[model samples]
Target: MKDMLWLMRNIWRSTIRSKILPVYLMLPLLGVFLSALTYSSAEDETVLRIGVANLDKTQLAEDAVQYLDGLSHIQVQMVDLSALDGEVASGRLEGGVIFEQGFSEGVHSGKPGGLQMVSVDGEQATRHIKGLLAGYVNDLDAIARIAKGDETVFAELYNQARSKSVSLSGEMVDDISADQQKSRQSIGYLITLMLFFAMSLAGNILREKENRTYFRVLTAPITSRSYYVSNMVVHLFVMAVQVIVTLLVMRFAFRIDGGLPLWQMFVLLVIFALVAISISMVIVASARSTALATAVQSLLIVPTSLMAGCLLPIETMPAWIQKTASFLPQRWLLDTLHSLQQNGISKDVYLNISILLAFTVTFSLLAVYMFERNEDTRVFV
Candidate 1:
């Protein structure tokens, strides 16, 4: 135990003295910041700008403008009739709604011209706005028929219907927030960074072998087993620091909403970190040289991370790619994180946790077996 501690201390000193700790830590922080920025930019895209040209100059046209303004996802601007086409053509407006003259009288007489939607861009925004206008016109048509050509009766009933309020009450079945998407993306990038760091640490074994430090270390009181354990301990310490710093920056500095409790999130990340370490061990055990280990790490980490939804969303990938991702540990960790965010530590959380542990143990056992069978890498017993 004492030897392991001493070995750990030395490894920590070496890592610090190398002066690359900040660089390694900076990568994950940068990833979190970039992901946050990307999500913020995307949030702005959800709102559509619409222009209204009221040529009718009647209460009906004014009411239509009010309805458009009331939509939560739309920003309505009352523009001159001539500006509507230019605005839509220049992309200043997603689309335009034009109310022709006598729109109100025509509606009352059941002879209204069809509503016109102007758009240069063939986007669904125009279609959605048209649908909203169609629904309002339909309601007005129903009210006209109810009045039976009586202007006074139509005006009375129209005003009453417009002023009428329907009470609506319902609990939110799913607490969906934009912040949840931001958290998922931030954590995804962080997981990729963690894997890269783990691989770098695992390659330290190859570095020691290259520099002949492995033989010298074995000559001391430390057994090969203690040396490997010490390395694993150091890897965990570094990963813990990375996880804590990233989470703190996300929660406090950036004000990201992590739908799960901080402790639960920390626990989940730590468990995933173990999987990363085990996979790194497997890489080191399989490669015969430092270069081969580095090459193998690059080949495996990028593709696996891509598959695991660390680099891109799993849903965007092909069906077969997503299916293959189910077999990867990173995917399971992300799944658990997503579950915690959506369901808040439900029963399925345990299942995901168990799967991550199973992956870690499997990788660890395989790495151990590989190390044991290969006498050439006797430095790791």
Candidate 2:
């Protein structure tokens, strides 16, 4: 125990004196701030701008325009038919809806109406606009069928339908807010940065070996097991500090709503930190030199972090890539964060935590085996 504490203290002192520690400590803060800025800008961009060109000048056309304006995700503006294409092409509008002169007449006569959607954007952006217009047309078609060309009765019934209301009361079975999504993304980036920082311990171990301090330590009363344990302790301590500082900044400084208690997030990150440390041990154990270990760490960490949805949401990736993410420990940590946000400590959380713990133990045991079998590496000698 004494030897372990002494080694841990030395590791801490060395880290404090080194230039690399500040870089590692600053990475999470910078990453979180940049990500938050990006997310804020993206949210602003999601509000679609649509233009309505009502050539019919009828009650039905006016109603259609009003309905479009009422939609929560869209901002509708009244515009001329001549301006529709120009506005859409110039990027002032996402899409335009054109109501022809016979729009209301066609609905009254039970004939197909002329409603055109014009947009330079792809089919996906205009799809929702088409759906909304289709709904209005369908409702008009139904009213025409019922009225059988009686305009006065149709008008009366339409107004009556608009005014009628039915009471609705029910408990929310599930709720996933936008704040939760922001929190998940923010936490995901932080976790990825922590994993990368944790892997730096491999370089530390390699440096000690290169300096022959590892041999000097072995000559003392400390066993190789105690030295390794001390490394794990130091790595975990650094990770914990990173996690806490990032979370506090996210909650207080950025005002991000993580959707879960800070304690829960801390617990999840600490578990993932263990997995990261163990994986670092494996990398260091497998490499015979610091350069090899550094190369392996870079090659594995960047690609795995990308696959694990650390850089972007997994849902946006291709199906096969998402499937590949399942094998990564970072993916499991993100999955755990998502589960906690949505379900609030359910069976899924336990399952994800268990999977992370399994990864930690498995990688740790493999690292130990490699350390014991490899005689060229002086880390455990």
Candidate 3:
């Protein structure tokens, strides 16, 4: 036990001394900041600038403008009839709503040419406003029909409709979409970094073997099993630190919520870190040389991470690719993170966790078998 602790301490020191450690820790935070910036800009895109050209100069026309202006996302500006088209076409406005002369009379008489919607971007920019304007026009048409061409009744009904009161209750929903997306992307980058770090640590076994350090260590009070166990312990410690530091920066520094408790995310990531370590062990045990191990690591980690949606969203992938990703441990880790984020604690989380553990055990066993079966691997034993 003392020897294992000593070995772990030495390995930890060596790892922390590397310049690459800082990069690994910083990349996730950088990703989170960039994601936050991108989403902040995207939020601005929701506000639409609309020009209102009211040639009718009636109560209905002004009321429509006020209604649109009162909306949360639409910004209605009163513009001249002549400038509406130019404003919309020149990209100064998203779209325009024009009320031609006699719009009220047309509404009362059930005529069609009183309203026009224009946009350079066509339906994309004007669709929502079109719907809103249609709704407004429909209400006016209903009131006009009820009055039946009586000026006094139409005016009275129009005033009543303008002052109509209905009970409405609203609750602010905290939109975690930007934060959630940032969290997912940051964690995805972290996962890839973890895998690469695991591979780097695992490669030490081959390096030490090549340099006779493994043999030298075994000649001391430590056995082969003890040395390997110490290495695994060190790997776990470094990975745990990676998870902790990255999440801390995300939560406090960036104020981004991943929609799950910090402890829950930590536990899930730690489990994945174990899987990463086991995978690295398999890569190291299967390869005869450090160069071969590196080649295999690059070939396996990036491609598998890509398939697992650690580099891209799983939803964007085709159905067949998503199915194929289900076979990967990283996919299970990410899916578990997503499940917990969306559904909180659920059966799917447990199922995915079990699968991750199963992956760890499977890879650990495979690595052991490979190490034992290899004739040129006396250093491992």
Give the top-scoring candidate (TM-score): 2
Candidate 2 lDDT over 234-269, as tens digits, reads 889888888888889988998887888999999999
lDDT of 1 by residue, 258-317 (tens): 787788888999999999998998888777777788888789888998988987878899
C-alpha root-mean-square deviation, candidate 3: 4.0
lDDT of 3 by residue, 1-381 (tens): 888888888777777777777776566666667666766686675778999988999877788788899988888888998888999888889999888998878887755358788998777877888888888888878887888878789889888877889999999999998788878877887898889888877766786778767667767887655666677788898889889988998899888899999999999999999999989988887877778888998899889888888777788988999999989988888888889889999999998999999998898878767755553445343
Residue 189 miss distance in model 3 (angstroms)? 2.5
The alpha-carbon lDDT assigned to residue 140 of candidate 3 equals 79
Clashing pairs in model 2, backbone N/Cα/C closer than 3 A: none
Candidate order by TM-score, decreasing, is 2, 1, 3
Local error of candidate 2 at residue 258 (angstroms)? 1.5
What is the TM-score of candidate 3?
0.80
Score residue 246 of candidate 3 by CA lDDT.
Answer: 87
Tell how far residue 101 is off in model 1, in angstroms.
4.7
Model 3, 167: alpha-carbon shift in Å?
Answer: 1.8
Query: What TM-score would each prediction reach against the true structure?
Result: 0.83, 0.85, 0.80
> lDDT for every model?
0.83, 0.83, 0.82
